[model samples]
Target: MDEIIRQRIRNSKTLLGPFPNFFYEKTPDYPQALFLEWFQVAVESSVHEPHSMTISTIDQHGSPDSRVLILKDIDNEGWYFASSSQSAKGKQIEINSKVALNFYWSEIGRQVRIRGNAVTMNKERSSKDFLERGKIAKAIALLEKQSLILQDPHELEEALTKQLIKLNRNPKLISPSWTLYKVEATEVEFWQADKERKHIRLQYNLRGEKWVKNLLWP
Candidate 1:
């Protein structure tokens, strides 16, 4: 079974469609602006979950850890994602603030990688975000102890029932540990894959308060 899975994966291909006419001429001029533009294009193309991204963080032992997370927001402030302060990712960020984000839209043959520093959002803003979340999401945040070993699966189920009651009583209740983290990008790379494998790689580095752009070899 393992060999079958490996063979299928190894034989699969990418970038098989007729090359889009503008792809060859397109160059990343402004990193953030290009990102927003590409994101909208992905949406128009019906790419599923365009705002989902993989975030990588360094654990205390210097090992790398990563998980897929929904992108909450983006602007001149880099990117935003939410987590609990006691979550595995949150603890890792506390030990080391440096992190990376990866966005891939296979339907568009595009990817964006960002390396940056992460900082917790202010309490008021974090609270607002929590309040905006659905009741079930709020109940999960109230759990606070994520990624923990469970002796029984029903433990969380029972806890969630109690939390739902609490939320029903006070919809405004907010968990102190639920936090929003923002990444301030120091380097951003935009990649576009070509059928011929001569991929485009454009990188932007933040220096002082400005961004310097450079083209990278395929």
Candidate 2:
């Protein structure tokens, strides 16, 4: 790499800047309640793609891979997201059920981290989720045979064309292989960026059957 690019990468660690003015002992224990509040704040702050979050999963070899996915639903059950059953992330989840989801709202200077075990939703639910996605998204999902090697660009283009034709014929058609999954969090942490010194950190963990919440020093 060039020296300038290397320097920029090295110096990026210092950009976290001291902390900020706000500090909270904890972000309130209840996961649903606190997350709802944070979500509302993110929405009101005009954060673009607030529902978009990073999902990190580990393969059988224990190597980590991550990709951004939009949150499909959230409630007392768990955080929901969906993908094609054949996608790398979905396959990795099968091998290693452990996963982490992260959210960073740059405009509001806030972040949330969730560590959990994911389980696939039923086919009926998965189909509903897939059908709810926009037509173009459904078309794209149908086009990709993820994690497989491609020998020819024209082959993919041809596949995409055929998929689009099929999709156009029936807009309500859902990808048969698409899967929806929910990550049942074992632990969750909420971090609010601080501009000066101290910051807010709250961690909620599942102990036995009960949820225990704690505040961590930042």
Clashes of each: 0, 7
The digit string of per-residue lDDT tens for model 1 on 1-218 reads: 99999999999987875534334245554567778987888898888999999999999999999999989988888799998888899999999999999999888788899999998999998998899999999998898878777789899899999999999999999998989999999999888877888888888899888788877998
Best by TM-score: 1
lDDT of each: 0.87, 0.83
| Residue pair clashes in candidate 2 | 19-194, 19-195, 19-196, 19-197, 20-194, 20-195, 20-196
Q: What is the alpha-carbon lDDT for the whole of candidate 1?
A: 0.87
Candidate 2, residues 172-217, lDDT tens digits: the string is 7777779999999989888877665356778889997777987789
Q: At residue 106, what lDDT does model 1 achieve?
A: 87
Candidate 1 stretches greater than 4 Å from native: 1-3, 18-30
